[model samples]
Target chain A: MNRAHSKTKRTAFVVAAGLAAVTALAACSSSSGNGGGGGDSGPVTISYGVWDDTQGKVMQQIADKFHESNPNITVKVQITPWDQYWTKLKTAATGGAAPDVFWMNESNFATYASGGVLANLSDKLKGSDIDMSNYIDIQTKAYTFDGKVYGIPKDIDSIGLWYNKALFKAAGVAEPTADWTWADMVAAAKKLTDPSKGQYGIVAQSAPQQSYYSTIPQTGGQVISDDKKSSGYDTPEAIKGVQVWVDLVNKDKVSPSLQQMTDTDADTWFTSGKAAMIFEGSWAAAEFKEIPYAAQNANVAPMPKLDQPGGVSNGLGNVMSAKSAHPDAAWKFLQYLGSKEAETAQADAGIVIPAYKGTADGWVKAFPEFNLQVFVDALKNSSQYPSSMNSAAWQDPIELEFNKAWSGDETAAQAAANSAKIMNDALAAEK
Target chain B: MTSQLVPPVEQGQRRPTPLPPRGTKRRSLRHGDRYWAYLLILPTAVGLTVFSIWPAIQTFYFSFTKWGTFGGHEWTGLDNYAQVFHDPELLRSLWNTVIFSVMTLLGIPLSIGLAALLNTKGLRGVGVYRALYFLPVVTMPAAIALVWKLIYNGDTGILNQFLAVFGVDGPHWLSDPATAIYAVGVVSIWSSLGYNMVLFLAGMQSIPGEFYEAASIDGAGPWRQFFRITMPLLTPTTFFVTVITVINALQAFDLVYLMVGKASPAIEESQTVVYLFYAKGILQGDGGYAAAIAFVLLALILLITAFQFRVQKRWVHYE
Candidate 1:
């Protein structure tokens, strides 16, 4: 009888233990849930998400500045690394827990804006002191969809020719100039290449933004029509553009083989002094400045022209989630992010060229050694970065098809034709 | 007489113990124990239902639906499944998966041999040797792949440099389409060898030492005994190891993703089913198609594992 009594007591204890564990779990979750709720009467904290760890600190500073003006609203900066940024954002947005404000890029702008997840800023802008005209036209245009602005312009980037002056001097070749043409650049590449020393004159990477994107337009080709309904890859002009890069590696032997470039990226080759020149973006200035070898030797020139000056320009914009718990607070922070003071701070940091028209002068003057003006000037002739509703679907396949041409396994025309067929199919599917 | 005496004493002891607890009390005690057992199991049961079974059901349902980039999805029937069957990239990835599975299986024999060597009698510092071989097993796979990527680099890699010493120029190991999958397979084998070897060693040790002793008495040589006894006895372990290795190889993604990357020419030739699923589903936001690919892979694994179990009956001896 005593044993049965003890057994019942032990059983009761076990049940109680389990209940305790479950209660603790429930308590933890409820506490976290309460933390997310910010009543209209109380101070609200909104999160701003960005990629790029190097610029995260400056973002925090901007957030702090925003908080100083709007004492009732606190801004929290969240940094997700570039590789995982989109994947996290997609999952979070799907779960209705995305950051209140986040950085949006041109390639992905349409995907997010059309999904109805982004807050419509048109009405808000009309009531606020923020003028859309203060930002670059291309950026503002890129962020607008169906006659409504979804994002505020943040920064602009354009490609330029980054040359190693010391390598050119050693090869007895003249440094690249603003007026240089495609033929002149090719001739210099031949003189700069030294096979015995394992040095390449230039790196013609398969990257669209740095290499083929600029070249295709320079050769009078378009990646997509203005309506974004079709691909222009099969055009003779596009084929000619692809052929130029292929010929550099296969015929001229002035650029490293595609295999070599794949093993060591173009940026590494330039920074290591193994390549005389590379086509790079304005965003690379801060990274180059930190690399002593590259900073001492590298300078920028306008991208050499084919039919006309050619480059690709892309911009980032700040967007807010439509489902934000505190929309008013998020809008105030978003406006502050696009303000002249914020733009000047971004420009002074020299990490990027602010989208505000006159604010870029600070960025240009930040690095006096290099010709930062070339990046800003290239924007004038540059085409907007090509994108469609489902750009990623076609972009990957296009890169793979182009890689065959880069590897010399297929002719430039054949690869371009194949890319067009696939791109067209992807575009059709998008509808 | 002793058996008769023992039975009555045991009965006496058992009878009195039960007699003290009346039928009602005993029944109540059993009910109490039953409730306690359920409480003990609740946490694990809840966890498995929520994390594993729930997601699996969701994925199965999602395979028949098309998803928009952000949130909403539409019921698309077998459209995603139909596309999966027709995809050329899926076909290529399946072929790569097969080649990779076969290549990594080569490690099984290598592991068995190493395990035998380590199990030799009077081996000095066996612990140290085992730890040295097991280092890769404990290391993170991403770290291993990154280190191997550096070693497989075309120009400045230690591997190419070593090959240069022998006056034989090496092809680019990772960037070259012809060699990338094989290079990644080699790393997979190297990392998994320690794990497989440990299992084999345990299996070897479990075989009674008396078998070898008795074999020696019967005039059986070391090689003869190993082939006739150890190999046959190790069949069950070998079966388990083979099934696991094949499943893992078919699911190969992390090493390929980290080492070869999307931009490499080798990616097309080296991508596995999981890699394609990641690209289509996550990166490109084609969740429905990715779910379909996952189901296809799951079906393949189930078919292969069922086949392994069926085949093992002929060779695996429990006794």
Candidate 2:
């Protein structure tokens, strides 16, 4: 027993020693943020950070292409999961150790730009062949702060109606067309629903972008005022937009219950043949095309309109860090990332719609089986995804209130009014 | 204990009287030895001061401020704490945490029973049974979460399929707000079984076999022997396990965060205190509010520990 005790102690010591060595080695490797400036005559490695793992492969290809042009500069593509990307980036920026170039979302770019964490790219826009008019107006305008461009637009996204052709055929319902209206969607959903067979026409998730964001404007409502000072949830149009799904899930029985949707998301519901229809973004096309069921049965259409053809468009931008050691090298990579060459690579991958104008056709052609062009067309009348200085602060409250409405715990009108109060307070606190 | 003494020999000699007037030079060889020990501990001391102590101080200071974007902050007095006090969700989460701790404490008795069964005399394949029970504790949380998610899924989960044998349909375990916290609690108990049972087994084995033999000769049945002898003897282990389990359960986040997920409808009820802090601090970029939540948890733990110490006197028998 004594010998065994000593043996255990010895083993524990060895393990501790091993862990310390590994930690030291890891720290040494991760502290390599030196290669940012273009002054390095020899080989220099710059970090290019991205969030989506799917799009990272194409970004890596872009890096390779750029390397071919300027062999002295090396771009290392780093992919962090989207959920943790901003949090990790915030910590890195605080430590003065952010990536040389990183992906930025419009909702968050303002906060970082205001904090002086993003580099001003006005000079780059002026000097380079990258024309301001080449990209979508809202996207370019989304990344601008203090009338200066802080980031170059990467990809533009718009919501679309994804429906299963096989399900529609079996139900004897016509597939959704470009001219489908809100009433047409509800009618088709009712006809297609077969609840006794454990199938629903759609899965109405507690999702903002897919459901409320698109439908709100179509019903003629704004999520926030033009000055971004107050909430629009209290408006009759907004309440109608939110009530559309509540009525579908609870009253019409054409959609799954809120609990079921929470257990398995709408995307999974649509993919598994349980749901005939779902509202999804263009970014989902790549994933859906990969799934055999969706690949064969699923196709896209523009989000159904009510009074006018309207949807919500959001985009990602590529920005250089303000504290980058190699600012010139970082800027060069940023230029290449936003160029037609990089956009073509992204389009050919069919993962996302490049924000670059006239390059969306390649994305549509990449997935010829699906009607991917509906997303591009939807962008023509889409509004910017509603954002403020700190979006998550209010987004969380709105979602929480909306969940109650979705769960039938509160009336849509009541939930909308309560959400507006919370949103207004958050907006007031932002300044 | 040693006494400080005046030299009585100084009275016998006048020359010694001058030396007695001054302080005595008492020699302790162990003191010099500890100097070398302090040197040995210097590295650890420095590491703790830099990593642990500094962060604790910062968390306290930041609790009094509002975190601005990009790591900047401004002094905000007690506004964060005021918000924390007024935030209904924070209160709800605290209540949820308390419920989780109490539910998980139920595992203590269940584990003790399993430990006794494993410790049965002449039991065959004891090692195998121990390993089987211990597997969940060793498994990765993410993998365990996925497996449990599949089992708890309402549509096609094996649990509901089993319930269908009785012509019953189980609720959506991880998604339904009514059952999500309890579902997570069940997983928590299953995971904690090994650690608690090991402690109980160690406590049981240390008990003298003669006590059981004596009890048997006095016409005590096996059940009586367990209740009278084993229970009292295992008190210390029970006390230790109880305190540790309470602390561990109060800080519960991983299972709830993984199983219920952020998008689940049950998140409102299923969120543990740490999960709330994570959302506010890490996800929402509100570090000051997060710091305040951390301190509230810290204060709660201190109070519970004090109460446990007071209650422990009634049960734990050190001898």
For model 2, what share of native contacts is present?
0.32
| True-structure RMSD for candidate 2 | 8.0
Local accuracy of candidate 2 as per-residue lDDT tens digits, B163-266: 99999989999988999999999999999899888889999999999999999999999999999999998998998798778877877888988998777778
Per model, kept true contacts as a fraction are 0.38, 0.32
Name every residue pair that clashes in candidate 2.
A36-A326, A37-A325, A37-A326
In candidate 1, stretches whose alpha carbon ends up further than 4 angstroms from where it belongs are A1-35, B1-30
- Candidate with maximal lDDT: 1
Candidate 2: stretches off by over 4 Å: A1-39, B1-32
Candidate 1's iRMSD:
14.5
Give the C-alpha miss distance for residue B241 in model 2, angstroms.
0.4
Query: Which ten contiguous residues of candidate 1 chain B have the minimum total lDDT?
Result: B1-10
Q: Across residues A1-431, which tens digit of lDDT does each residue of candidate 2 receive?
A: 24333344333333333222222212211212333454666778889999888788888989999999999899999999987777678778877888999998877878888889899989767768678778999898888887899999999999989999999999899999888887899999998888688889888777899888888888899899987888999999999988887898888888988888877778999999999999998988889988999999999888777776677888999999998888878888888888888987888877789999989988999999898878888888988888888887888768878888888889999999999998999899887
